[model samples]
Target: MYAELFRLDGRVALVTGGSRGIGLACAEALGEAGARIAISARSRDEGEKAVRHLAGKGIEALYLPADISSESAAQAVVKQAAAELGGLDILVNNAGIARHGDSLDVKPETWDEVINTNLTGLFWCCRAAIETMVAAGRGSIVNIGSISGYISNLPQNQVAYNASKAGVHMLTKSLAGEFAKNNIRINAVAPGYIETAMTQGGLDDPEWSKIWLGMTPLGRTGKPSEVAAAVLYLASDAASYVTGSVLTIDGGYTIH
Candidate 1:
């Protein structure tokens, strides 16, 4: 009976940016736990492939297309997921973009793009999902954040990304406080130097990798599945009492 608390059978989940990297990994993990999945991405082909992969694992998954940078598009995604998947019990805000520029040279347009996609888009999805979830009286939200929110990466400056992620941390807390009465929980997962396509450049540089490993107590970069595990834990009833929390899956990179 206790084991059932961790089971996600019959739960419906919507994961933004679910075509690849951390989002796809979370989708896979949740699917394995028996949750029906709606994998949303801007790339139709990738979204279809992700859904197929999940389906192959015996999980009911659907491909929903949305570019979360557009507020209207983000809202539409939640509506479609709710309509098609029956209702959403989980929402993972994993859609984000990272653009690097000198802090002083970063243009307003780029800053706006990063903020719109990473922070504002997350709000739009949460707002839409909450409409149905509030009526349902139960839901779980996991916002994918990054260690860069707390500490900036050297060499490349991404002030917009850092600010957006910091906002995400507070956003999760604020939403959790407001929605706890509705039986809805909101939490965030901050990942450190994960080995994803976005970070391949850093890993390819032996000197950079050495510096990264030196900073990371684990002496290695993290994998997407590791971040997915953190998400799965927060999504499941195993974290029923957890809300307004930031679970860091950084492999000790933030300790120093």
Candidate 2:
């Protein structure tokens, strides 16, 4: 009975930016757990390649090419995935970008780009997914937040990225409160120093790696799979009573 709660045989899930890294891992986890999967990303090539890889794993999946930075595009992808996959039972808002720049030196457009792509775009995807979820009377939405949302990173000037993730956390809680009556659950995962293409350069940098590992209680980089496991739990019936919570998977970095 406990194991059955994690099973999602007839459910459909949509993961934005699911072509690679953490997003891909999330897609794979959901699919392996028996949920029909659909992934959306900006790169058509990467999207197709990811779909092929999922096919190889025997997880039927769909690839929707879209830039979540556009509200229309975000909404369209959700609608398209729901139309194709039968209905939207789960949504993982993982499409985002980051940049390191001193607040004083950052351009207005740079700030806007990061905020728009990371925060506003995520909200747009949620709006579309929620509409479908409300109609269906049940849903789960998980946003990919960052450990930086809880604390500032050292040796990096990423005010915009930090701010955006903080927004994601609050938004998750706010939406959860508003939609719980609709039988929709919203949550977020805050990851720390996960091994991904986005963090490869920092991980390779001797100075950055030293600071990072030294701060983490685990003293190692986390895998995308580690984060995905948490996502899988939160997206499953096992977490039926859980919502508005931001599960932190940061190797104890935030404990400091």
By TM-score, the best candidate is 2
Best by lDDT: 2
Can you write out model 1's per-residue Cα lDDT over 1-256, one digit (the tens) per residue? 6778778998999999999999999999899888989989999999998888877877778889999999899999999999998999999999999988788998889999999999999999999999989999999999999998789876567899999999999999999999999999999999998989878887898887878778899988999999999899999999999999999998898888
Per-residue lDDT of candidate 2, residues 171-204 (tens digit): 9999999999999999999999999999998999
Off by over 4 Å in 1: none
- Relative to the unseen true structure, what is the C-alpha lDDT of residue 134 in candidate 1, on a scale of 0 to 100? 96
TM-scores for all predictions? 0.97, 0.99
Model 1 scores what on Cα lDDT? 0.92
lDDT of each: 0.92, 0.95
In candidate 1, what residue range of length 10 has the lowest lDDT sum?
149-158
